[model samples]
Target chain A: MGELRRDPVRNRWVVIDPERPDREAALKVEAQPPPPLSGPCPLCPGNEAMTPPEIIAFGESSRQRNQTDWSVRVTPDLQPLCRIEGDFDRRPEGPFDVMNALGAHEIVIESPQHLLTWAEFPEQQLERVLRTYRMRSLDLRLDGRFRSLIVVKNNADAAGILRHPHSHVLALPFIPYGIEEELRGCREFYARKERCAFCDIILHERVSRVRRVVETDFFVVLAPFASRFPFETWLLPLRHASDFGKIGEKELVDLASLVKRTMQMVGKVLGNPSCTIVLHSTPFDEPHTHDYHWHLEIIPKTAPVAAFGWGARLFVNPIPPEEAAALMAQQM
Target chain B: MGELRRDPVRNRWVVIDPERPDREAALKVEAQPPPPLSGPCPLCPGNEAMTPPEIIAFGESSRQRNQTDWSVRVTPDLQPLCRIEGDFDRRPEGPFDVMNALGAHEIVIESPQHLLTWAEFPEQQLERVLRTYRMRSLDLRLDGRFRSLIVVKNNADAAGILRHPHSHVLALPFIPYGIEEELRGCREFYARKERCAFCDIILHERVSRVRRVVETDFFVVLAPFASRFPFETWLLPLRHASDFGKIGEKELVDLASLVKRTMQMVGKVLGNPSCTIVLHSTPFDEPHTHDYHWHLEIIPKTAPVAAFGWGARLFVNPIPPEEAAALMAQQM
Candidate 1:
């Protein structure tokens, strides 16, 4: 039998079960081998009939057919948290708690080629991928039932189950509690300081320079001062933009170049690390009156959360962000 | 190169570095069989002289003593994050933040037998372990320089590098920013409700009984509505209590027994899965009047933070806590 341990520092709890006998063996059970690069993945172009119907598709000039000439595609997820066909039963279970999984979940096929990533593509093709995300966001926001629309790109084999590089966009009927907490935090800071917390953080990091991992014309990537994990980094817009959809064509081009550069930098240092890129934008239908700043975060898997860390809700990082940044910078 | 991905929900950043790989690999590389139950294991009872001098010890009496007769022991960590000897340097150098790792780190060797946990121990033995933790907390509180004192137990191999079933205690000179945020949240709730938020939550969970995982004479375990991971459970006192240091002797025995039962239940269901337990308590020298509720969080090692989760700080759990509680209830 395992013991339950408490982290006195963070006041978090973790269960310590030693019964596995081979604690490391648990890793192998989920250690899915990398998928083969070759062959016809249904997500690949010309395999349009193989997948669910495309919600939106961008193809080469003079192309009318659905799958054959598409550059970027959007379709309903085969397995979705929120079914598209449901009546959205918002039946009440109790007071202070409402229930229903009401939302739209879709997958964005970033490229026609199965093997290539947005970064791996030429600049023009990548721009079209960006365009598809913005177009979807605009369409999703019109529903009014959704309190928020989020677009996330979980790239690489380590970050996602499927090897093909793609992104997810979700339209939720309710504003998630976590996002509300963040908004509250940001609102409090902005009200007191009369400045955006993220902007202040950006300026602080730029001045400090020690935590920076990558930088480009429109954005700067750096590790946070109070990083929750080792080697965790975020990409923030240099300008205070509340909406990702509001980013112009020039900025999108710049973002594409920077994404490639940042990914290249990380790949060099960590060797095709598993990572996620999230678009933290303002909630839908609401006027941009709060201090929320849009950004993206990338995490490379480096250390496993051990029992103490898991139990305590406190993370003990062996490497500091400054050390991580300095190491990555040297590689660059 | 791994491109940054975004989560459409909670917008927290994660890193996906593939270079370091898994900690399981590290264990294999060491090829260390679990240490023989016999011989000079520093944590074992008879090997008292093998470890650093005792900070606190029990059994035969609460008074400090020579090594041989002790049943429970506490000592300064041989390798500590905050060493006993260090300069308190808080300065910044050319864009780099620097500070001395000023804090107290120690280990509590739970049993002299080296084979039993608090759950496995007799009532009298478990009571003593709780008493020692209280004494240490009070003593550490007097250090005016420190901001918070956190005590934790990392039992399984997944909890830490060392496989020993031991717990740790740390006192930091700085109150971490994360803790500060939580404090603010707790206070805000209290100010509005004129009651502790945790107290209200406990009452709510007890009445609902929907998310409750376990109940004992002294404790009740449940899952938070906004659980970030599957099977994330919290064990709390049935009655309102601000600090672990203040639990009475009768309550201590009950709590220990409860912990044992909980562990066994978890083992039956998850095959003694690797988990973490964290203890949350009031910071040293702080007023007990704060609307804080000290509790323990137990997190099971269910899955890794994939790109979307890591990138966006949003978690998409396939299983809900209500469903998870039902599964756990079966084991009970």
Candidate 2:
């Protein structure tokens, strides 16, 4: 098990997962030329034995475990950042607070094949992937020990060592500082205007249309007004949905289409740069409040994050959001 | 001039500096075979005209400006993220807050010989570099238009495009979110303990000595209790100082030696990996208070920051700080 330590001054928690494989060694493994496409891939079909026992698989039969028939499969992380079996065991070491990194680290294999990229997946397959996300989020919340579920996809080698199309689901024991801030901001906005902050953004973006890139019947894609990175875009549902697990089949399909199209546009413009797509939703155990709105954010890895960004937490984006939206809109 | 836009949801400001030269183009330029070390090095001797007119230079005579005799020189950024000439014309754009990115961006040329890394510099030369930082910081705060001065060094190609040994001084009209959080955290700790949070940390680290990597007469280098990155070390002054600009000659020399030694240890352990050194101090307009303590944070670029860190503002440091400190202390 790993430990979560809080910075004495910043008051933010850092997950110090010593159990995580050596990062340098992981990079070395990734730097080596990948094996041929037909080679053994743990996430691919017929290689299910290479991974841990499957927790769930969306296939013709739920009875069949760790088989090649599944379109989307969920399994435990080979080297989990945090173990699911341990108690939080919160304690203080001297002046710092420490706790067991108790939660679930699972991988959601997006497809059965060795398809390397998510953007190339068909819309139906992508919808199944999104559905699997909803299912796992809903399933993980039943464990009272979990406070938040973070769903993220490291799309390419630039993002991480994972070349296979997969997304991660981390059931965290506490609300991350970033999500807490967003929730606080939303609640504050609600206290003032009795409206969701994200809903207001959607209304404002739709009215302005300058920052809007593309929209489906249920979702809207636009560049964030204060994008931290170039080509940073958000996919927000038109409906006021706080929990991603509450997404209906129609909304999930629409979301899949919107995500696929937006990603394709980003790839076309940025020349298929590596990117990270994260799903941000209301924390588990939180009430169905009207203040919060869930969304997906896609950040293309266009440039290295230098000291200025890391030090100040103030990002200097060379591309204006309006210009980025317009550029993507042109492709749409 | 650039614009600063506020993320209404996250309540953080982002600098959209369109005038910044395209980063891709800059990388392309750097990718080309470098010119000879002595050939037309902009930061070297006889190249004073290559940069913008020197704002200040320290050498044999202080009166000489833009001359090759200067051991250390300060000049305006050729492509500044924010310009000093403009007023921060604040306004509201629908649901967002906006202002002109009005501030100062300057570069401190560390050496006249085009030394690429600060780690190789002698103790005396490093002390002069530290002195230049204090002088420029004090000078910039006198303008009254700036709220914070962020001094950072991007050491080596991995950190940035600048190949010459130099650091950046960015004077911003508003406090960055990162600094704001640290100040808030310190204030909260002070409210509870009636003592400076960092001072308490210094006492604790000294007493425990587990995370302490190096201890000099005036400063202590230790891996922070909740380091966000591997081999992340902080250099804290023994005396209570809210501002870096207040350092005296003795403290400056001591800090220089401490920083050099810490960097050497890090380089030795990490094999000279590119790193970033950031100076965190009190805001310019804030009065001297016990609620803030200045320090230097060095983050080695051992691994790429993936989606989890970017989206959640939660860092998953693979190496435990205790282990990291022990590794560095082996060399120290």
Candidate 3:
């Protein structure tokens, strides 16, 4: 396993994975439909031996693991960002901090079939996907070494190298910088207002409804007020919950329907642009139950990353959130 | 004009430029060599009328404004991320905070000719470029509405839509989040150790010299200890300086030479990869004089922005800085 290094003078961590494959492989994914796979499609049902042995799979009650009959499956990432084993050994390298890249990286195959986009994923299938996500989150968090975990889905021609619809579960030894910022901000806001910052935003957005894109029984999907990208949509649960592992099945079903519809709208209005779906839950070990609210963000990759704001980490969106919401309404 | 919006629960700010031009044009830059200039090259000598009126230029003693005789020039961005006018208005849109995109965005034409890359810039011409950055920075600071400014240069074939060798000057009404974080880190370190964080980094780096790529009279260019990307280089001033505008004429000459040589190495080793050159100067009107040190960071566009870290604000580097340094040394 490689190691993680802390920026000497900044609050950022970087994982130096010398074993990363020629990342150029992902870029070629679009051009090579089968993704330059060795034999048959590794993700497809019959190619069970192709990928690392399945970690978990949901299929017929009569069937065994790694079967073609499976609906959803999870496996160790062939190109893991962080390895599965290590003592999160942190030592000082001169004046800088360094630690082993200890945690888990797994692939959540949303479907065993090719050509199925999230927009086309059935509500039942998406619900299964969410369950798989929660299962992996819970399982990974059980490891005392991991501090944070995320379920990230990349769906775009540019970024979606794998034609087979899927997501990735990344468990890290520490909470990421952005999450730490939000945790700090929410903690301070709660200290002052005695309410969760996300709950306040949900209430405000519901009342204003300017950037609201969709709302279900248990979730409210909205274009965030300060969207970093055009058509940037977010899904926040109506209830105040910090941990994703605590999500109930009924809530997951509601979320799955809302996600399916939201993705369909995104595809219809935005021509199915490349986008990222990120699940931000409370860190594994943190129990700031009332101060933080878990949420999901869907960011359309509408702009290049090499813009002027790259250095500053500020984003420049070509369109405002209200207008984006209106665009979604038009398509709806 | 566009406006800046703060993320409701986080510290990040984003610009919503409704009038932004076709950003995809930059993607097409590599395909269009002269970059599809409508008429004559805008930055070239005689066609200076094509761009927004020139702000400053340096050339022959007898030359007039916006003349073909200039060696280097500066102009307001034709399509700025933030407008040059407007009061720095801050208001609440429901539960979120926002302000007008009040700032100056100028283009610094590094060379008169379109074909000259920074690596090919003559030392004298590059010095003129640095002088132009300082002049505009100082001029923009006088506005009092601006809080921080960065001199940014994008020279990748993928991002360099304007074929002319140039950089940008962005002055914002607030310090960007990255700069703010650095300032906070530096201040906290100073409080604890009574030493400038960057000064200690410079000392540690010089003593180890493991990641040092080049050193000159006034600058040491090194692969930062925890580089976010492979070959992500930082050029730190040898002297403890907190403000970029305070750089003297002699130091400017040394910096120019170092910059030129470093760019040459980056070009040779990285195959003229697209990269961002950012100057992190002290924010205007703030004087944490002893705690901070201004520096420049050069990040290679080796990875896409839509990576998983896009959500976490963490970074995953494929290679370690030591190996990256070795690669640089091999080329040198």
- Winner on lDDT (2 vs 3): 2
Residue B99 lDDT in candidate 3: 62
lDDT of 2 at A143: 95
lDDT of each: 0.63, 0.74, 0.73
Which regions in candidate 1 have their CA more than 4 angstroms from the true location?
A1-40, A61-66, A83-95, A117-119, A174-182, A204-208, A285-290, A305-315, B1-40, B46-50, B61-69, B84-99, B113-125, B174-182, B285-290, B305-307
- lDDT by residue (A117-180, candidate 3, tens digit) is 7888888999999999988888888888888888888874454446677888988776767777
> Which consecutive 10 residues in model 2 chain B have the weakest lDDT in total?
B23-32
Q: For each candidate, report its DockQ versus the true two-chain complex.
A: 0.13, 0.19, 0.20
What tens digits encode model 1's per-residue C-alpha lDDT throughout B1-332?
11111211122211212222332321111112444444466887667777788887776664446467777788887556455556656565432244555567788877776554343567676666667777787788787777676666643434344555667777766554335445566777777777876777778778899988878888898876556555677788888887877777777777777777676665555555555666777766674455887777676655553334443344555445666677678876
Residue B326 miss distance in model 3 (angstroms): 1.7
Q: Which rank order by lDDT, best down to worst?
A: 2, 3, 1
Stretches of candidate 3 above 4 Å error? A1-38, B1-34
Give a tens-digit lDDT track for model 2, residues B69-138. Answer: 8878889976566777866666667776666667788999898766457678888889988988889899
Docking class of 3: incorrect
| RMSD values, in order shown | 8.0, 9.7, 9.2
TM-scores, each model vs. reference: 0.81, 0.88, 0.88
Tens digits of per-residue lDDT, candidate 1, A165-273, equal: 6788877665544455556667777777777777877887888789887777788988766455555677888889878878888888887777776766666666655
On lDDT, the leading prediction is 2
Q: Model 1: what is its DockQ?
A: 0.13
